[model samples]
Target: MYRILCVASVMLAATTATGGTLDEVKTRGALNCGVNTGLVGFASKDAAGVWQGFDVGLCRAVAAAVLGDPNAVNFIETTAATRYRVLNAGEADLLARNTTWSFTTDVDLKVDFAGINYYDGQGFMVPKALGLSSARELDGRKICVQEDTTSAMNVAEYFKRYEMTYEAIPVAGTAEAQSLYLEGACEVYSSDASQLAAIRATFAAPADHVLLEDIISKEPLGPVVRHGDDDWADLVRWVLNALIAAEELGVNSANVDELKAQGTSTPEVNRLLGLEGLMGEMLGLDADWAVRAIKAGGNYGELFAKNIGETTPIGLSRGLNLQWTEGGLLYSPPFR
Candidate 1:
């Protein structure tokens, strides 16, 4: 009865929200997050059927901030073609999949991107035996790519600019493409460089394939929520910013509690940790919202290091994803 009343109160609060998805989420007792269709290091189930990866961290963090429970998330696997449709149809509350933030996807599709979570570029992969040193060398090779994605359009643009012709094989998802690529059915597999690396790591002979050094297109990947949900959007956006900001503030799971307990003198640290500001109240969350989110899976840097960092199987260097102080593009707005 206590649990039922708590959920009812949450639903009552959600009714006043800018979007109905929050109400639905509170009613269901979990956040429905759309994720990639098993893209290994980004979003994939483990041996125990637990969803784990970088993007999964985003979903769990958002759930923690809103519902106060990191595990209160139902991850729904979505395909490239069907991702936005699924979000628009209300099958998912948040699209935490590795979706490129494009003007068309944001404006025309009637969805708003919270922010760019991962700065990436489209690239290609080929067997080392192919001896393809550059993407330009694969003019006649058949390329495997997921359908209805920036990858396919980028492939077309790259080929057209070079005046090259190649066979484009559109697959339904990454698993099939990986299967075909491993079986030598497709000479090239193209996607975001991060994804290509992740997929390559999953290959039986990881050393047999190589990702081309040439990046063909800029892909600012991030989470997406439906348009016009100002309240929901602000909460989601700030939760992401909180993670990024916490990293910049030198706060992590290891030190956050200590920082909160000792009362940091830094104004931003106090504001972020809910000891000295009303930022969380502005977003309909408690003062400890940021703390909950950061503790859910550490700060942004920690999650990156754990999931797809240079030390991981993916071995991706934080080129553009590094903090601004470190000469990268990651910068969060002020907490106040």
Candidate 2:
């Protein structure tokens, strides 16, 4: 009897130690998501002080999968210089800001990028009064860019490639860059093209500004989590994969529950929605984890449409962002 009790206690302790982030999250009852201070299509708070955007939707989907409540999220607004610090310091469970997936960030920052949710490129936005038709025309001009980001490197590279000399004024965030550009402190504002469009929509005089046609560098933005936690990483990665899979399987938020009840006819959908497999269990979650996530915000395409699609003020076209079948690079691995 004594030996049995001791073995039972040892097993319990081992289970507790190996439970990973899922157990920690269940005990805390909330997910901490790091977001931008204010970027329209990525992450921003509304008049009611509620956060909503494409990246924010990803956070909500994770929360729904983990905590079963889409609103069980704590948004921590962070700047480019501080986002990685916050994640590495354990201040956030996930970083869903508009961060580019690069070799340095992935390897040196001690963080794991789950997947690329947005395929973007850096561009320049300038006032139409400048009569500039291309980025190459802006020689020796002051460009406002975000500090501690890939934008600065891309800006330097673009200028070097064109044999042009220019002054780059690094701002702390996107809002500040927009402000500096609008106040004529800088000749151009440089960032992602989609972000430029979002900022242009909020301008007091939208028609005054135009985005230059040159795309300098690739910016594949995605969610990130701390390194050395494979279970947590898998949970986040699969949640994103489920969103993409749901879109591929023709599932949306409105019909998610019905599909869940009826069960999926397709094997891929069955494995994704946890109808016939233990995929979620392998990631330390229940079988219906993907189902809960899809119910929270439909699929990736739906989330994009509702937040930053053509109908929205961002008005972005799915040029290189369409799925593999649609001739774009937005394909995901099979759920099985």
Best by lDDT: 1
Off by over 4 Å in 1: 1-19
What tens digits encode model 2's per-residue C-alpha lDDT throughout 1-336? Answer: 999999999888666545456777888999999998888877898999899899999999999999899999999989999999998887899999889999999998888999999999999999999899998899999999988889999999889988999998989887788889988999999998988998998888888999999999999989998876777888898899889978988988888888778986798877887888789779877888898999887799999898889998888888788888899999889987
Give the C-alpha miss distance for residue 195 in model 2, angstroms. Answer: 1.7
Clashes per candidate, residues 3 or more apart or on different chains:
0, 0
TM-score list, all predictions: 0.93, 0.93
Model 1 steric clash pairs: none
